[model samples]
Structures are given as structure tokens and as C-alpha cells.
Target chain A: MNTPNTSPSPEVTRTYRRLIPNTWWLKQRSTILFMIREWSSVFVALYAICLLGQLWALSEGPERYNALLAKSLSGGSLLLHLVMGAFVLYHMVTWFKISGRIFGSGPLSPGAVTAVNYVVWIAASIGVFYWIF
Target chain B: MCLIKFIKSLEPLWWSLFGLGGAIAAFLFPAHILIQGVLIPAGILPKDMLQYENFAGLLSSPIVRIYFLALIVFPLYHAAHRIRMTLEDLRIGWLNAILPLLCYGGATTISIAAVVVILRLS
Candidate 1:
């Protein structure tokens, strides 16, 4: 007995599915947002390293440390602060938006997970405020 | 666990507010003495220290240190989690375990290091 061919016909082209959604707006916005978030990490890391260096200087001696500190407080430092400040704000907002997605409860219940996230966020804000101020 | 999650959830907003507040203070109040007098001429910091140190110091003060630590630790946790998701989104399945471990491990190391420095300073 002859077997029938199962291969695709010559006129047909193979189709590929996208991992992400097909909405053009969503794809563009998400790509932009992702780039912002990823690059912001680098800035945050830079800020962390600067802090470590400050700590090192303070550990060394007063005069040297104070001078280094003074320089950062003046001139172009102000401008840099403005830029980093914006990036940091963006970072914070995006972080919160993504928080629920990261640690949400598995398929058991959806709203329950979101509720838990909001509660935690509010409580943390209160606690940090109390501690800081 | 709930309490921890609550704090974790609030972290990004809290940090954003704090960072913004600190940035404003850095500009309006202008810790000129701290930056120009101590950080700049002293010659130990990286070139960018001219821009970073004052804001960082303001954000990294003793009280702020606690906040900073929380922000650092939690944001990193958040980052790791998000990164894992992104990897999976991209169909990079094998890295799931390693990514989280490295992220949390690095975060913990940094937190410990910061704590040590803070304690030494105090």
C-alpha cells in the first residue's frame, strides 16, 4: 500500500507565533518601558557605588573625606541630581507596577493576590514613614 | 509573611518619594559645603562623585541608611523576580533558577556590606 504525503503543500508558508502580544502599541510601549527600567538599574547601581566610596572616604580621615563631600555638593552636581531624580521616580513607579506580577499567588486566586499586594504596599509606606520621620 | 509583603509592596513608592524629596532638598537647601568642601577637592571619589555624593549622602544618612537598606534589599528582590519573569517571557527557561539565586545572593551581599559600613561609621 502507498502512504499519502503529510508534508505541507508548496503554496503554503510556515507561520510563526510571537512570544509577546501582537498589539503594536503594547509592543512598542513595553519595549520602551523595559529599556527604561533596565537602564535605570545601571544608574541605581552607580549611586550605590558612590555611596560605598563615600563610606570609604569617611572611614579614612576627616579632611580628605570632607573635601570630597564638598565637591559633590556644588556646581554640576546639582544638574546631575535633577536627572537622576527623574530616573529614580520612574524606577519607583515601574517597580510598584511590576511587584504584584512578580510574587502573586499561583493560579489559586487572582484578586486575592492583588489585594495582598496593595495591603503590603500601604503597610510598608506607613512603616517607612514612621521610621524615617 | 503578609507584613513582609506589605512592606515589600510599599517599597517602590516609598523609595521614589524619598529619592524625589532628597533630590529637592539637595537642590533647594543645597548642601554646598558637603559637596564642594568635602567631596570635591578631597580627590578620593570617582569623577561623577561631583554629582552623586551629596545626594547619596543625604539619602544615605543614619536614619536614611535604614530606608536605603530596605530600598536596596527589596528593590533587588523585585528586580530579580522581574528579571526571572522577563527571561521566561523570552523563552529562556533554563536560567530561571540561577537568575534568582544570583540576584538574591548579590542583594544580600550588598545589604550586609552596607550594614557593616554603617555600623563602623556609627
Candidate 2:
């Protein structure tokens, strides 16, 4: 039996070089991370629009408002709420991960920036709770 | 880096934060019944009412106004930023310059309009 060459051909090496640079791996990883960060917004946007619809129904009439509200609070809505909750959590995590990359140093420390996010989120939650009740 | 160029780059950060912040606020909170139900439907509200606000009454409240401002301002910024990023990703060479300008310019316009309406209400 004749032994085959183990080394790759020069043409294959050139093709590989064209296909991916030394830094391509890092770029690929970053791009995937970026996509994850970006696409999470879809869930966030959908739920937000649903909330807007509820608001619209409320403005329309009590009957419509109550119906929408009931739908929103129904089991199906609850399931959606759970999904959205998970999505938002992912959003928050990825958001912070990219935050440093996006927002360079400013007056606020990284800790301070993160604290602001939590505080703002908590405050919004309280506002909504008060409004709903 | 040129001052203008540096400022331009920071635009993405501003927009992203604004968008993310607005999305977070909108999702987590239920619409305020009084605002969304009573005031907005009543047609007594300002035109620029937030989903949570049925009317402009909340605009009078400083705290509520701040929240509203944050919601409006950040989302537009986020949208603009995302649009710019999308364009950059496509690697369309010629359109790059005009794309960011339009995105940022449009965002600025909307922000101004919102501020104008809010200030007028006040």
C-alpha cells in the first residue's frame, strides 16, 4: 500500500487563510454574543407591545379593558409572563456584559452603573405595582 | 480621535442604553389604570401619552414625568443605535455615512418633539 501525504496542500492552506484569519475565531465568538444580546429584545418588545394593547383597551372602555386585563392575567398570560421574565433576566445579564463595552468610563463607576440599573428596575416595578393596585 | 468622531461613536452607547432601559420599563410594568383607562380614553390626555399613562396628568407629576422621559428618550436611542449597528454589519460601504446620520438625526428629531410636547403641557 502506498502512503498518502499527511500535510495539507498549499491551495488548501491559501483557502483556509482566505476563509478565516487568526483573529476570526475571536470575531466569530463576539458576533454570536452580540446576536444573543440583540435578539433578546424581540421578546422584550413583544411583551411591551402587549402591555400597550392592554392600555389601549383600557382607554377604550371598561368592558374592553376588563376583558383585556383578564386575558393578560389569565393562565396563558401567566405562562407568557414567565417566559418574558426569563427573557428579561437574560437581557439584563447580556446587557451588563455588553455595557462595559458600549459605555466607556464616565463619571459613574461600574458598580454605580450596575446599581443604577437595579435601582431603576426596582423603582419601575414599584411604580407599576402601585399603579395596578 | 477627532472630537466629532468620538462623539459620534458614543452615540451608539446612548441609543443602546435608552432602548434597553425603555424596553425594560415597558415590559415589567403594567399600564396605570387611571392613566390608561380614565384619562386616555376620555380623550383629555395629551397625544404623546405613554402606554402606562392614559393622560397628561402624570406629566404634571415630576417623578412620573422623569420616568416617562427616561422611557421615551432611551428607546429611540436604542433603536437608532441598533439601526446603525445593522447597517455596519451589512458592510455596505457607501451607505454607511448617510445611515448613521439619518438614524441619529431621526432619533434626535423624535426626542425633540417629545420634549416639546411635554414642555408645552407643563
Give me the candidate number with maximum TM-score.
Answer: 2
In candidate 1, what are the lDDT values of residues A1-133, reduced to their tens digit?
4357666665665566556542332457777677676556544544554556666566555666767667556656555655555555566555544444555567735555556644664565455334422
Q: Compose the digit string of candidate 2's lDDT tens values, residues B7-121.
A: 5777657655765654543444333322343344445554244333444344456665556555555555665666567656655668776776666676677667656544544
Which CAPRI category fits model 1?
A: incorrect
TM-score of chain B of each: 0.44, 0.62
User: What is candidate 1's TM-score for chain B alone?
Assistant: 0.44
Residue A131 miss distance in model 2 (angstroms): 5.8
For each candidate in turn, the interface RMSD (Å) is: 9.1, 8.5
